[model samples]
Target: MAVPTVPRLGPQIGTRLMRRFSSCPRAYSYADTLPNLKIGAHTRVLFQGFTGRQATANVKESLEWGTKIVGGVKPGVEGEHLGLPIFPSVKVAQEKAKPDASAIYVPGNQTADAIEEAIEAEIPLVVAVAEHVPIHDILRIHSMLQTQSKTRLVGANCPGIISAIGKCRIGFQPLPCFAPGHVGIVAKSGTLSYETVASTTRAGLGQSLCISMGGDVLAGTNFVDALKVFEHDDDTQGIIIVGEIGGAAEMDAAEWIKDYRRRTTDPKPIMALIGGLEAPTGRVMGHAGAWTAPGEPDAQTKYRALEQAGVVMVNHPEKFGHGMRTLLARSLSKSGTSNTLFGNGLQKRGYHATRRTTLASIVGYQQKRSLYLKEAQALEILKLKSVPVAEGDIGSNGLICISIDRSALSPCIVASSDPESDPRLLRRIPFSYGQATVENHPMMADLADQLKIPSSSRDQLGSIVQALWEIFKEKEAFVLECQIGVSADGTFAAHGARFGFDDAAYRSSGRQEEIHRLRNTSEEVPEEVEAEKYGIVYVKLQGQGSIGTLVNGAGLAMNTVDALTFHGGHCANFLDTGGKATSETVKASFQIICSDPRVKAIFVNIFGGLTRCDMIAEGIILAFRDLHMQVPVVVRLRGTNEELGQQMIAESGLPLHAFDSFEDAAKKVISLAGPQ
Candidate 1:
């Protein structure tokens, strides 16, 4: 494999290198992209959890916005509700309503079942609003739909979709904020999705479909899937994808667009809003699974990939729609959509077409129409400035070849001609190129080998060194070896800091082989480093702080957190005991909290959804027994199992204080912290 020498973007001095890459390379302007398409007004919809608070609230709002919500599916409660018939099964709902799309509001564990049921009922579009669904559930649902039903599963954990002009608001999107139009909005985050929609609408362009694909770890469908749908949908003029930090989904989508642009004469314009430039890795905000875990994917890499593929980059979301319109208008002119006259037979009909053409020719009118081409040329200029390019070479295998600069070199060694290099030091450590790019260009691989580097060079030397540093420090290979084949993050890149498990025999057996196995199995090894770092256990009720935490019986947890924050408090963490709390789990939960230094005081608030509050109380008591406590503990026990829990806590005689009302308990905790 040949590695072509590429100029590094940021400068490096001695052993220190400056990596100043931003989130993603490109941003989108929503204001520039929206168009008015002829969309239908009737889009029949059904809701699965119509009885739930969230479902009812969202449905009522959707109904007010002209959504024809024909029916709903609720177990047992099957009378007329929300002015729609309620059924027990999706089949029953589908039969009565003949709905085109459905929205779901089931719990995480049962979300897969609900979605599968909807798919079985032949619902073309389904949106799930359940969070923290198991990863296996998402995979199974997507895989089953792909093979068995061919159903379009929108989200396993998402806010849902909305078609502004069509009046087809199938998801939980707030309709009042949306207007009708041609911009297609796809986002990973719900709030960001709404922001993009509002921005586009405010910019005088309506939306075709605003799809929030859920900001979960394992998503249902990717950007390419949504793009293809938009490409086929006549109402959709362009797509504005709102992405967040994490995953290679964006870059993969960009790569797909590159291929799509190559084949299609009339290509759908794509703009992107990839968020998370300031996001810190390992610290997952919002969704639990949406964390950017180490080297998987980030915004900067995605931006670069998208820019390479010719996606128009903008800065503000408000400008995205307008930007798209400008691109489209230019595209229209390039395709000769403007009125033109020909021959003397037309008689110039009170207008001189020849004179117009003559004037255009005199000052280069055709150049005004070639925006995309001009942009591509500008990119070429930037590319040349970033890298020293060489021409193609002949190969026996019909492969193209390009080599790096090797003006002065000795046999079996490449040397850097630096003034500071000593006579002896100059004889060793040859200079090498670590990065190259080739679109099925054969010369790249040959050039890589000549440069004494690998063929999978994705960026210039700075990036390559970064990847290498990460691999060395992290003791993990900088490569993603899929089942189909092997692909490196890049050749000659620095590695990430190693987890403790990387030092194990499994990793040492062969980094590449271990990575392949890990990728294939989707299994994670135990890293003592993380365990050691976050070993202490701490437990608290949903109370004041950021990162609102929750478990089963989300209503109770939510209420508790709400009350806590209402009293000038915030829930720093949410820990749900689910149905029942075990002593071991209680201890483990406490340890998790103790591991977090941000937690000052602890609140154990529970309103037993299924199991009694007494069990949770007992678990907390036992946790204090086994784990030595250093922080003040406040407990709020109510509903099912409260007596038994209180009895156990009292019997423990560990001086643990208890409370009933969440507010009172939060006040006590606030007081314990001593003012503010």
Candidate 2:
């Protein structure tokens, strides 16, 4: 012992802590001044369901990464396997080989039990990789952790956490995609996180930690939880949040970041990349929890929210690394930290650039000049075509100026066309403008009539709409107003008509014949056609349901429908109030939902962000007062003056059940309506 004294790791740990403190004192609160407890080289891991295929493979890979996987747990498999001891239970294993953390690999059905076992063993950290676990089970598991506050859970359906600096792995994240550095990655998506990490590495930025917060609707951890950890972690200098559609987690994080920045002097620079910009509304894309609800935050909403919160938002996923690199460079420069590491990392990654372009130039380009048909020309063409035109003047530009009837067009598709030019007549119709109306318009009524005729007649509304749309593409003549019905009733109406540029020219070009042929040809209505027919923001066709939903966002609408369906209920229709939920809009939305004979009960879920809850509640109260709402209504209001909204609803003395949670409101509605 006197001849050979053991070398202490204390100085090494102290040096790391000191470096972290030197960078930012706020990084480590006084209570958390000691080194953060994370899965690292020195931490021993216990594998739950070790004999399982997923565990076996992951353990082998972890061991290859030099992770200290001490033992495993698998009932009735108490024998040595993979050179690691297998125990009957976590308690028995803890007595022999103490594990600081646990990696759960049991089937989803048994995942909750395994997690409970780990918590009972008092393991500080538990990473659950099992997907498709029953949501109820996860809720219970989370509840269990709440009681035992010391235990931390990573995921229920996530890929898990990785510490690049520690060279330790706790989940199934690909190791090659990671590098040890200062940026911390927190995401609800596993594959997206991998892509982000790879991009960061490519950009010469390494990560301190990468956490996949799981894709389940109810994950054990969220963006804020992970962000708080990264905020205090000494190793992490910056943070990147990769979020997608569905849930208010990202929005919540943005709000937290706003407060965090306001409260702290040395706030870390944060960047966000929100996926699903192109994702269609109401559809579940990829992750189980990645569906957007009506009025719920979409990609654009999330982007704006994060940006407003002072976070750098990357529009495209591929540019995450570039965004982070640029952000970190700026942050470091502002903090007077040397950016030599960034340059060296980029150089090592084989990146060479003589000059750096602005992010706006790199990510987005200016719009190309559009072909214009002056408003005066468009009005003259409408008059020539025997189309009814509202009294209105024109702007200096070619854009149409008319009194739009918002009421008739509850939801309308507005398009423009040049009625003069004959080149590829049908292809020229620009049906770009589409939206739900807040008031009734005459053009909307006409449009609704046209759509209704085709929808009820041959069900060839698409062909008719297409045929009519070609009128807009003519020449210098534009169709000022084109409206199509999005009401429950199928109808199409148009305020303006087209006489195919010069009739002789249109006839000679053979486009008129093609248009006629398309209109006459009866084709089965596509799903999109149906969607367009009714201004339904989102709809899931179960083919049966007496309950309908009037929700704020598409994500919330979908969740409401899901909750109803899960509780043995059915949805008659889906109506989203969209982003601008004014009293009139909300009233109109409720009327649409209640109009459906099948809808015996209505579930109104509004999670206000830009749309104030008080406004929504006022709308509901006014709608019921005016319409004498016959259906049972369950309303759940949260966010932005929610209490005031609730009080307003209560004072209105309407026959409405108001609750704080969507789950409770949904359950109440379903119970009142009975099983569909």
Candidate 3:
């Protein structure tokens, strides 16, 4: 039965939307998922794929940690797996168990199907753990969700949620790392969520609820969705938002926080930690959605936004506990003393109020409307998203991305270029939807004075910004990098423009052939091209390195590289078999790593949530047996079927040494590599 939906909060988000990106944003709302996240002892939970190896393992752990596992769904399986009734479908299980929540532990490809089953059954809340879920599936699932608000999905690639006080743990987060307390946590990175919980728990603050929203590019439940729930919960007095780089979720959260502070009474303090600040722009991070895309805000942008929102910002994960604790106390102190500057409630930040938008924040706007692309959904994923490009993204980018040159003082328009790298630069100036046409404003003269652009190039900068903004607002674009040259002498050349349009928009565009004709495949990496054919992502590093990593999830892969680098080791390549990997694919990936002649050592780190551990172990063994391996392989396995995986490695007698901890395994690989 569909339950009554809570009206999504923060219509005030429109204030910011109007100022920046779009005139036509639908009432920006998502299901209030925090209520679902508020799992208590009485909240009966049902597991889909209950009898599967991964699900079974996680269910046991959840049960052991005090989760209310009333029943599960497993078609063709009779009886129960863990003293809980195992029905054939979510509907049957729902009827029997009367479950309020359902967790799907199916593989990545099947995650959407399982979620649909739960949704169709009217399951109020669904938590999915597959990391390799297709982006298209999430887009479809989200579309289905917007129609009505019966079902709320958490992760197709997350650890799930846990209520420290409720004693209801849905995901695979470390139990010891969490404790019942006053802080509510929401994050996209499962690994970081664990660290946040541990830090907060150690600080003696405990937690109200911890939500791993999954690091997929498009999350079913977002930062605002979770924050709205926490803002009202009595159990949650403060919030620790663990955000990752990439996309505008954090920035959006900052906006919502600013609006929420303006409206709410004595709002709880929020402390945030954004991960992968140093991650390469083009390379995908361990968390699937953690990397900075071409036009998305970087970690610093998000940090500044959150800081300006009165959120206590912590640069590292370990500071989560201390930071929130201090912020909460400080907030309390202010609340009691109204005479304090800015009163008791969180003060409005000058970030938005300041006329000078000095620093550059890579914000994206579209040429054509499709799904609400916040900060323009990553231009990289649009091809697979099926959102067609009305007009492609192209620009001439210099070595540095400068946010604003002196003329940035204007609220209506902003232009940027590196002062040191090149005085000549190209900029996208914002033009409003109504009344304020490009011709309406002669801001180019002001910008020219600020940028010291010679008289000859004033028209050049003015025309380009106007043209780009008009194109962006009218047709819509996903990503673009353009260059507007301005020399010391004021001469100008608009060269080096590259653009990519939303593929989902392309189907209706009837311009697919024309766009394809403008293709620039020459810049494509050959090894990456080959890996795509094999259904994997392979990005070889620039320099010859000794270690190669074969990991399951994007976040895990990036972290593995971080750990290796921290241990004075360099990774030869980033080879991800994706969320669901067969023995064939795993063996193939292993071969790819071994083929890298620079690889003196290989590290196999598999955190099997839905993906099985034994299968990965089998692939590693088979690869070594098939070809006498020249390098030592350090293996670390956890999660589903990990015990069997470890036993397999023990029996195989290959040079693969298995460890239970990431630190130990990383150290082993680094040591085995013996020097640079």
Top-lDDT candidate index = 3
List ranges where model 2 is wrong by over 4 Å.
1-37, 293-295, 335-676
TM-score, one value per model: 0.47, 0.47, 0.57
The C-alpha lDDT values of all candidates are 0.49, 0.57, 0.62
Candidate 2 per-residue lDDT, tens place, 629-656, comes to 8888888776557788888887888888
What's the ranking of the predictions by lDDT, best on top?
Answer: 3, 2, 1
Candidate 1's C-alpha lDDT? Answer: 0.49
- The candidate maximizing TM-score is 3
Worst 10 residues of 3 by lDDT: 402-411
Residue-by-residue lDDT tens digits, candidate 1, 194-248: 5457567767777887776676655655677677668878777777887765555
Deviation in Å, model 3, residue 555 alpha carbon:
1.0
* Of candidates 2 and 1, the better by lDDT: 2
Error of 3 at 512 (Å): 5.1
TM-score of decoy 3:
0.57
Question: Candidate 2, which ten residues in sequence have the lowest lDDT sum?
Answer: 362-371
Q: On a 0 to 1 TM-score scale, where does candidate 1 land against the true structure?
A: 0.47
